[model samples]
Target chain A: MSDQNKSLDPRIARLELPQGESIVKPDEYWGTFEVFLQEKRGKFHQHVGSVHAPEQEMALVFAKEQYARRGKCVNMWVVKTTDIFAFQLADEDMFATTPDKQHREAGMYKVRDRIQEYQNRQK
Target chain B: MYGGGFLPEENPKKQTETVAEDPALLADFQARIDRGEKIEPHDWMPAMYRKQLIRMIEQHAHSEIIGALPEGTWITRAPGFRRKMALIAKVQDEIGHGHLLYTAAETLGKPREQMINDLLSGKSKYSNVFNYPAITWADVTVIGFLIDAAAIVNQLANSKGSYGPYCRALERICAEEAFHLKQGHDAFVYLATGTPQQHEMLQAAVNRWYKPIIHFFGPSDKESVHSEQLMRWKVKMASNDDMRNQFLDMYVPKVREVGIDFPDPNLKKDPETGKWNFSDPDWDEFYEVINGNGPCNAERLAVRKWAEQKGRWVRQALATPYTKSTVPLA
Candidate 1:
């Protein structure tokens, strides 16, 4: 924990920084915040937000302030960017097999309607 | 008087004090923001406006985190498997809300760690209502139903706020809160209509939570200073009193319909004014709670501090030596 304040270790810093062309990106320091958004409490987490923070401590703070400012957030997860494995947007089509399916959904409203229809038929 | 659109009336108090900003500059800023311009981190804003937004947003973030504790207490001891799962999901949502709010604050160029450190150091504020203890399981339902429902009203108003990110965040939050309100209302309905003992428990919970709900909106407009600047900046879309009245107008009848009595004897609706009148919350108590003197303040802070301390290793691990190569953030 004491090491949380220390600058990047010399060996790790050398390994992390890209050489030459990749270094063309001007913003050398990039941080990742893992975001969990709640529509409200008692619901599954929706990935509605993320932010960049240099450290885990900062990320936690950033996550709460950035993601949970409104009264609706019930929880948040802020993790360093390196930990999350996500597919690139350039490969978006590779993950889009059944991207738009609206017909077969059955939850909350659907269940309510189905139950009401069944009760009406019985009546 | 009813569902007032955008900004309402000019402040009469401005006659006594010089308006803080050059009217033209403020108007220009307001017009740009009204046109759906995104106010970036380094954008020019009035000092008072920035300070007020920070206070409001940070307190809101703190409220989301602390609001979880009361309901979180009931998770393990919930009456049944379904209730337990519901409580767990609710608490998780509270954590998620905290994340959304923190990000909102970060856009203001304030360091997130500084805010958390301030909260832990007793230098920041959260909602005053959270300072009250939740001593009964029925209190959990009251929190979900009445408290969350009231919050939804305020968030709905904020969805139209002038600040771009805050407005967007409020839109998402208000959408989620619709579910939360229903879940809480369902829980309250089950308890309120169940066994006699359950009914009594819910009645007691309502009695305890009612005053806190009134206090939830902070204070009347006269007592608020930053409110005008906040309104001008589109930071706060509704006055504290206006939001409180909306809560009472919506929830009071709902509570009565459920066969429970709210504790306030003074609660009555003025038909002509279209407002519900109720006894004011103790401003002293509200200030005390915001200043970290309320009943649950110590416990709430202790829990957060413990989590931070206990999780120190986890945070350190993420910053460790070997994994740095594979995990280049950029």
Candidate 2:
């Protein structure tokens, strides 16, 4: 037994570890599961965080432990991290706008003034 | 819970213009801030604003990860299954907060790996409170309740800051911290109202932690410098002294109601100013601790370094190129 382990609280020290060392394999990794939490009923699920698990069922259990232990979450979905696609930062320019688009805003119109003018003419 | 007031080093004379920007664009940016518009990642902002925000967010993220280590050690020895489960969940939430803050900081153009390297190299700073050890289980309650309360006071204000990603991150973090406060208060109440031994343990822990709790808000506003521009940009939401006073007003009565006493004999409220007044907590010691001389600074960093080194293989393996899998749900 290592000296550090001996100094740990007996409760933790007694927890068994798997026997023998395991070799790391290339191109293999613990699956990363992305967690989405639904805050309440009728609410859309939002991405919360991720956890590593060996299988989908294990991912769900781990997600519950990591993200949904609180009563705030009513539902949760766990998907592999690799499954999600995203736009690179370089593509941010595509979201830009050119020229003015004030016509799309309510403040751009003077409808209230025009309505008052029509009302006066009607009177 | 660890995102408390951060006092960057005094650099009042430091130049704010390294990368020159157009004067008209700068005026428009300041006008947008005056109108309370949030600055998104792609927005045109001064170089200094981006640098300060990155520094603040990175520090906060580091604080969360290191903050978890103290209470995390007590999980296995939490005395009961209920406490054990709660402690584990709380620590996990703190780690999650760190990841969220890292993502928010990454939006400012620094990679997460570079931030971690800065933390490992001691080029950045986290909350000084984590440098002290959680010696007893009762210390966990003190930290969870009192320290978390201090952080909420700071974070609630920062949630309204002018940075979109950081403010959004703080909004979610504040919500989770509220739950942690409840758990901490519940555990504290149990001990304070329990047997004589339990009460004694609780009191001792409180006394031991009182100084660090007071230090949690950083230096007094009068002694702080290089914060005026940051506050104007909304990178720093509130003054240090204001957050500390707010924390004391909200919590002092509760602690007294529990029949516990703070170590400071001069601790009281000023009726005229509606502010907290207490003896100085030795700013020299605060400086020393933040300079990496505190009791557990070395230990905390060593553990983090070990985790990073051991997990390198896992991170590398995960980075390997693989075909994206689509699993069907029944």
Candidate 3:
């Protein structure tokens, strides 16, 4: 489990209500679904927005209306908000790194200058 | 899609208050605009630019939310499951657009809550077209198709504006609106070509909405104020009359093709100049409606107030301090 999930309140982390439980509203329990859309065949699905739906079919239908109504998408995927794990804001520093990675950039190589020098010599 | 015609400020003095910037800085700013560089959120802007952008974008955000109410009423009453789902989603998209626009406007220094409060108190004005009511199901189609089409004309132009965030927001909104236009046109066609009763309903709706549609673009350029500087700043992308004429050129033929007659006897295009000439929709009534005396003005505000009140608990609940027991993701 992720560190963020590990730190979640035990009451919520351990809580799993039965299907159709009325204590907490379905919207609150069934929760949101994150939508991803692929604009056309073979394209990567892009994260769009979330929708509230109790089931997958309903979620897809809602996704179609919310994300694909303009024919901007040919395919979509909806995952339960709970099923998706994300790094916590507290863990954002994990992405921080030294800015000295010039070796990975094209500007660091000077390939164009070297090629021009070679072409001048060949001429 | 709905923002057209700048609303006059309630206090002219507040609008004219110019904070003195260094002449060089002002010239540099204007020079950057002349060079076609977008002014980012953190960029230095003249006080007037900030105020006018806030006013224009906040009014647009307000228009989105208020505009939702008229067609939102028809969600449950839509003819079928297909129409019901589409209406609900369309209205939801409108509310989402409002959220996006409010965020864009917030970048100009006004809080969304303050902007909405201004809307509720009538300190801020939405599009005047929404001030009129959507009286029938046919009205919904007319609004969705023609009104949205008009808004597209305006929005497409605004998308080319110099404000970075508002332009970006309009780009996405215009894309979504393309589908709304299609659905609207489909529904309108179904009713227009259906039974004679359906056709009559649609014709009446077209007649009822034609004046408001004309009014949607606001007053002519000849009567408008303060547009010259706005155009130079790229804040007002197109003149109201120009957008109205463009809308007519694109949609009037399609509307006529569907067999619905516009109420205006003089709504004909001048082939010589490619301008639309029509009897002026009653400007007096337009002024009165914009000043808060339209048929559905009070009703629209009341409904918005009710939604605000009813949604307060949910907002409050969401605002509650996160507890150790709370699962942030869920």
Candidate 4:
């Protein structure tokens, strides 16, 4: 119930997925495609989606082909999917959840008024 | 039996070996799951759970990142200005989806940098579909109609997953994806009903995509070692086979109605079982493609690496503390 104290830090060092035998060869396919999009030409291009492509040239080609086709874009960007970072959900309760209630939500001190009233009466 | 990557580890080798031995703790984990409470970022969790979630979330994130490739290519070449604008919006929506997913994954304790680093270093994995080259303008429609359709099926299911953050992200993403599916379908219908060349183009695109679309389900349920564990933990809302069946039921008639024929000669609907059946996907190729050996793998990776290299300056500039005096004039 008291999850308020947990904070998100987007700048932490990344985790590495152990590399195994890659499905695609280094020469055959571009590693991965990373995509970002701009709602309009002047707006910031935010990261959106990724795909595996053969090269930067190809990724850009693929990005333009795969992501910007239907009708709602002014500009688009693509990179390698391998270059981005991500997180896990299984530990959602651990790194973000806390046990003590005193620090989480402000509502934990619901009886502050009552305590102050009792002290005033005694005085 | 295996380990390493993402979060920093002292021994790296011993990281995977780190496991909670207490049965009580395991029970507590199960109890938490039962409470319908979101597992926050800083609570005790099993190592395997952490590993699995990282793998799954990273891949999902990667898929979002790469999935934007094909459509982005079509923006400049869209047959009309309206189509171009619509395509651009659709691409932006995908970017929004990535943000939602990255935020969701962050709630699980890993830093966004670490996740991105893993991807850059080739220590993380994403979906296999992006590795295929998009060869034609028609391929754009195919990707939108068929690829996004497959993704929507999966994302809709993911919307109900046990993880609160993932569920929320899926909720928003699925909404946008519905529009994407329609746009693609609309494109497909237009092309299918257009001139003979357009119809032929649609048909050829369908043939090109059918195998990849079917393969998008990942390995079949029978061969997937992690499917059972993921289901047990509610990480996976539906089995692979169930999702495949759902995709088939929704699309087979739709494909026919659009006047595009499904490529599988063996594809058939079993009235007795009320399920569609077809030749099995080549699991070996599926595994190979996902592992990073698809036709366009190297090309894709190189593009990413180069972009990252080029963007280093931008990233570094952003990382520098902002001072009002040094602010550049817009």
Give the residue spans of candidate 1 off by over 4 A.
A1-30, A33-48, A52-123, B1-25, B34-38, B223-225, B320-330
Candidate 4 accuracy as lDDT: 0.63
Model 4: CAPRI class: incorrect
Model 4 chain B worst lDDT run, 10 consecutive residues: B321-330
What's the residue-level lDDT of B5 in candidate 2? 43
Using all chains and alpha carbons, the TM-scores for the candidates as numbered come to 0.69, 0.77, 0.74, 0.67
Give me the candidate number with maximum lDDT.
2
Clashing pairs in 2: none
**Candidate 4 on B194-303: residue-level lDDT in tens?**
99999998888778877787777765555444555556666777776678789889888898986688878889988899777888768778667656677755544544
lDDT of each: 0.66, 0.78, 0.76, 0.63
lDDT score at residue B54, model 1, on the 0-100 scale: 66
Lowest summed lDDT window (length 10), candidate 2 chain B: B321-330
How well is each residue in B270-300 modelled by candidate 3, as lDDT tens digits?
9899999999688899889889888767666
Across B88-119, the per-residue lDDT of candidate 1 in tens digits comes to 76777677667567667766756556667777
Q: Give TM-score, chain B, model 3.
A: 0.94
lDDT of 2 at B192: 93
Task: Say which candidate scores most in TM-score.
Answer: 2
Which residue pairs clash within candidate 3?
A: none
Candidate 4: residue B269 Cα off by (Å)? 2.2
